[model samples]
Target chain A: MQAGTQKSVLIIDDEEDFAHTLAERLSLRNLAVQVACSGAEGLAFMEQNLPDALLLDMRMPAMSGIEVLRTVRQKYGMLPVLIITGHCSQEDHDRAQELGVQGYHSKPLDFKELFEQLVEVLHQK
Target chain B: MTDKHFMAKNLASSTHELQNILAIIKESSCLVEDVLQINGKPRMKHGDKLYHSLEVIGEQVDRAKVLLRALNSFAHAVSDGAQTCDLVETGKQTAQLVERFVRLKEHALQVVVENGSAHIACPPEEVIEALHSLIIQAITACTPKAPVLLRLGAQQNGQALAIIEVAGAAWNPEEMEQLAAKAGGSVVLAPGVCTVQFPCAASL
Candidate 1:
């Protein structure tokens, strides 16, 4: 993906408001954005469609981000996955890093830095 | 784990959800700002005030998020059965949890934490509960509008202590000593300072 070119990003977070807001922000930045409110929904969406990059949350009720990441990696290898979480333990962080997450960030997010990473991740793809 | 443990877990999890709500509010407000900026700020009437209001909302959301995060961390402080914990972080969490309550009574609670960890091995929840109670008592005893200070530090004997200072208030050393003793600690109240020295890890 070329820099400044339109890219599609999927944000998987259980918080509807956060996902919508992030989607709006990404869209404003000129990137196509899709939001899934749960890990299961995100996985279901990924089964049929692959975005340029993914933004995933760490903690969820039924299915966790780690579980989603594991499944995504096995099913769709090398797709850029960025872990965005508000509550994450160091153990989870190390595990996600080992799982080949492109980047990791904590909330409240730094949208500027997140956008730059999104662009970079899309470029990598 | 006891019922208290279950309650702490619930509180921590709730904070996570609360944070998401705050994030959404912040983002929605940001979207409004984005629209205002894209439409050209100078062209719209009352655009400046509207933008300023959005900014204020955003600031409050950010502030709420920080408090929620601190509360969340504090809730999880009890996750582990008695273990070593940083006194500074514990003091901050204790203050954050009850800040609103203090403010409701028209008083301020200022928590000042040192950089280094003053590690203490004990039931963090119990210690926090005891210290929090002592602070509240001290705050009640203090004059109106006086700020209560919760300061954490390491003692000469490598023990951890939380100093709850209430300006212009006289504390009952004997009562505070009893409170601290119940939590496996000791207290020294002088004029306006209530020092709570936690039990050593070895004792625990």
Candidate 2:
């Protein structure tokens, strides 16, 4: 993907507001962003669409971020995945890193940093 | 099993939800700011005011995050029966959670740590509750806008003392004694001050 070119990004989190606002922000930055409110919905979307990058939340109602990441790593090993969390522990960080996350971030995020990371991952992918 | 545990569980869940809510507000406000910057706001009326409003929203979200963090810590205070706790950190956390309470009563609450880290052995939830109750009572009884000072100090013989001083409020010796006993500490009273002393877990 090149700068100023269209890129697809998928965000998986149960937080509707965060997902939508993040999508809007990414769209403003010229990326086509889609959101899934649950891990099941996220996996469903991935079957039909191949996003350039992924933003995943660790805590969800069904199929946790780790589970989603595991499935993604198994099916789409080369995809760039970034972990987002609110109540992250050391165990979560180590686990995500072990499973090959591109980056890790905590909630109340710095959007500029996220945008930079997103672009960097898209470029790498 | 206990009510405190139940309340802690509820608070933990609720604060997690609240964090999600704050994340949304944060991103929405950021989106507004992004739009303004991308469009250059040259032709839009009230663009400056709108940007300022978004800034205010972002600031309030930050403030809410702090309160939620303090509340979450308070919620987890009941997770253990009795443990070694940092007196300074715990007092600061308690003060942050009830800062609003003091403000709403038109009184001021200030937390001061005169000594370095002091470790105490106690049920953290009970200590927090006792501090909250005493502060609220003092704030309510004191003259409007008077300051209530919460000071933490380390003592000899491996003890830590927390002093609650209300400038214009009278002391309640009997109630203070009960509160101190319930919190696993002893109380000392001055004209408008109540002090609770706890044994340090490490020293014990």
Candidate 3:
């Protein structure tokens, strides 16, 4: 990331501890970060605040990542969304690809790589 | 397409949950390292030890991830009744799936495949089970701490083959014959050496 450019990132995941811990790590890198423990909360947060990039977990209670992606695209067109998942089925993968998310990454991620990707995505805008 | 085993569903579900848990453990470790790297005093006494401990945690998490992935692959092996799989890769998966069992016996497994992969059209679960049975038999017959080696290759005529060799394993031709009959492949058993053929191998 460029000096003096603070990228804001929102992570929408059902895993509470994981979401927050990741948020904390990212925040330490000079980025404004927030975590929503569910798709609904993430949407509510989005209604008030929009981050530069969003990381959405694939499987969630009540609403899946694809469903959230659909709603996000409809409500806020062209928001850069990245898909994060533990294990994704082919059908969900195909759907996520169709939705035009910026990237799809698996869990147990390499933190440095993910940060690099976040930087790249932020730079694109 | 039918679920071959009632246990597979639970195994698959459990592995997914474990993967997520492992991911959190890793991220938390990374967070610790991040803090240390950024703000730790230059002369902190325990800094190096803490960094080494965090590295160990990261390595173990990576190791667990590999095992979990192998378990997940094993659980889903029975998804398609007629699915074709590469013999060499399947051999490696079988080795990974039996990690705990080998550890309990104070043993290890090594898979060897020369050059390109070999494909077999047999049912995936059956192939896995057959290779597993051979490995278990070899482990039991071998001396302590001996590595159970699975050699995957092809015959001169292009048929795929698998051989299990554990030094000092008791020779048992009868059991190998029966397994061979079921798989429509030939078997040759000798002391610490067993070779099984897969007649339905698509290619090498």
Candidate 4:
């Protein structure tokens, strides 16, 4: 897909394998995908090159997904961000909604649902 | 109550009690088999504690099985006759059922599973179920950003037992004690962090 036609997605997750696999899958669908191993790294990358949407993992070593989401919201208001988490509790879901997360998905991920949500968010934006 | 009614109720209660006793015997037998088969050196210092915990958990499973059997027997007594059942497998199956819950939580979280494959004599299901409760408790106690290091391995001593150690930020003594009590496990505050240990014995 051409650069202008394809949407850019930034995946921020601690799980290297899961992140890579996801990036590969999304890339196959003709989306430009960039990955960061941690929340801090993700923030730095976002500063340099803003993606169309960010897919963030909730749990991590240093800064959490929620922390990253908070930072992203502060720096770039109205940025479309998706919170991806392994454990999806009610509290997490509620918090993600409160923090203006554009989407949320629990692992083991439902790729179809995630893709649809990502497309919906990008279209709206 | 009428004589017939009283007799029926008494029979039901006795049947239930008998089932529970039989379950305990079967679980104990499996544990004995595990103790015999386990080979090599253990890792943790508290071998006895791990063994005792596994035994106790097995015993509890047996008790639950017996109770369930009694309920089943009461129904049979009221309608059909007493039936022969495989209590050993029942005990094992029950353990397995509990383990499923534990396995799901363990995989979803960032905890590491260290150690040799320590199978419980009781059913894999039961161990997982009990472990699930313990895992959830640990997850709730952890700080969001802090790393929760989970170690599952044998004690340093030569024993047919497995230990699950969840290490994280220092937890409230009261809260840890409450969680431990609920999960039938012990919680200790280690030097650098809080640790909860869940012991499982080999399953025959």
Candidate 2: residue A81 Cα off by (Å): 8.2
Instruction: Give candidate 1 misplaced runs (Cα > 4 Å).
Output: A1-8, A40-52, A72-80, A89-94, A97-113, A116-125, B79-84, B104-107, B199-204
DockQ of each: 0.54, 0.57, 0.67, 0.01
Q: How does model 4 score by TM-score?
A: 0.40
Candidate 3: CAPRI quality band? medium
What RMSD value applies to candidate 2? 4.8
Angstrom error of the Cα, residue A105, model 3: value is 3.5
Native-to-model Cα distance after best TM-score fit, residue A43 in candidate 1, in Å = 4.5
**Model 3, span A1-125: residue lDDT tens:** 55599988899999999999999998898899999999999999999999899999998999899999999999988888888788776578898888888887777877777888888888888
State TM-scores per candidate.
Answer: 0.80, 0.71, 0.78, 0.40
Q: Model 4's CAPRI class?
A: incorrect
Candidate 1 TM-score versus the reference = 0.80
Query: Model 2: residues >4 Å from true position, as ranges?
Result: A1-12, A23-56, A65-83, A88-106, A110-125, B79-84, B113-119, B140-144, B152-156, B191-193
Model number with the top DockQ: 3
Candidate 3 segments exceeding 4 Å error: A47-50, A70-81, A98-104, B1-5, B41-48, B77-89, B103-107, B112-120, B142-148, B151-171, B177-204
Which has the higher lDDT value, candidate number 1 or candidate number 2? 2
* lDDT agreement with native, every candidate: 0.80, 0.82, 0.81, 0.57
lDDT digits (tens) for residues B1-204 of candidate 4: 656446656665555445434433443444343544454326558867766776676666555554454344333333322222122232233333333344454523233344434432233222333444444555554445343344444332222222233445344568656655443345566533444443444221
What is the full ranking by lDDT, best candidate first? 2, 3, 1, 4
Clashes of each: 0, 0, 0, 30
